[model samples]
Target: MKDQITHLPDNADRSVAKQKFKITNWPTYNKALINRGSITFWLDDEAIQAWYESATPSSRGRPQRYSDLAITTVLVIKRVFRLTLRAAQGFIDSIFTLMNVPLRCPDYTSVSKRAKSVNVSFKTFTRGEIAHLVIDSTGLKVFGEGEWKVKKTRQRTPSYMAKVASGS
Candidate 1:
């Protein structure tokens, strides 16, 4: 069957569309935005105490300076920002110094090693109520030769579309 695709209007203005939607809870939304912008690198006293009271290594290896909680925190930050291990290490170090936390920050190597066996669990936020989430995506227009032309000239499958076509 022929593709039943319809193109969007060329005159559509994103700014105008955005202006149409009004925020109901501006204060709550603003607070959430501000909180999201502020990164909490240092753990509170209760968290640090809990980490200290937890299990310790029984094996006769090098004693770790930073606890599992600290390492896990670094790993989570790394994952959220899509940073390299080295970059994550630098980030944690900077944050620690800025916050004036007297805790030892783990090296990138230690974070990498500990991350292999770390169990990061996220708590469920729903209070026995069904929640719905909506996600929208838009395609980016690439400024290059069209796929058909490139494929014909190169006499090979285009790399961009190869994965979907070949299941790779």
Candidate 2:
């Protein structure tokens, strides 16, 4: 008396139900939604004051115009925004223009030149705790047996391979 099922897989009876997320807190949820699209940009006065390098006698070629801090700041911003050198220069100029700061933005060419010598150290967060890093040994040459030989011959994998695979 029942009709035969032509597409058995198309039926949802065998599939698990998808999860349903319901927001309980209206005020907190609304505030989080509003904050998601908001962006805040701020630079301290100390950094602004140190933007330009102090005039000093140079023994060799040409004296530096912008300070190392300025170069590092531009480079950091560029890296964070994934912007090109010229775009970074324009971004810095726009910020200064809007902020009414009298400082001049560094040129793209200058940034490119100074990048080679400037040592920019990026700060990494380990969730307020010391982070341990493990080095990968896969590319490293193992003294005993080669991976291809062991894999092809169906021999037991070495401990180093296991460690590399587990990333420990």
Best by lDDT: 2
| CA error at residue 134 for candidate 2, angstroms | 31
Deviation (Å) of 14 in candidate 2: 9.0
Overall local distance difference test of candidate 1: 0.50
- What is the Cα root-mean-square deviation between model 2 and the actual structure? 15.6
Give the CA lDDT, 0 to 100, for residue 23 in model 1.
Answer: 89
The residue-by-residue lDDT of candidate 2 on 1-168, one tens digit each, is 999867767666789888999989999999977865553445556666666777785688788888776777677667645699999999879977887878777999999998878766544322221111111211111222243555688875442221112111
TM-score of each: 0.46, 0.58
Residue-level lDDT of model 1, residues 1-168, one tens digit each, is: 998998877776553644577789999999977764443332456444533225567999777666556666666556545698888788867765776765555788887887766555432222222111111111111111133454568763222221001000
Off by over 4 Å in 1: 1-42, 50-56, 122-168
lDDT of 2: 0.60
Candidate 2 segments whose C-alpha is farther than 4 A from its true place: 1-15, 24-30, 124-168
Q: After superposition, how far is residue 76 of candidate 1 from its true place, in Å?
A: 0.4
- Alpha carbon deviation, residue 29, candidate 2 (Å): 3.6
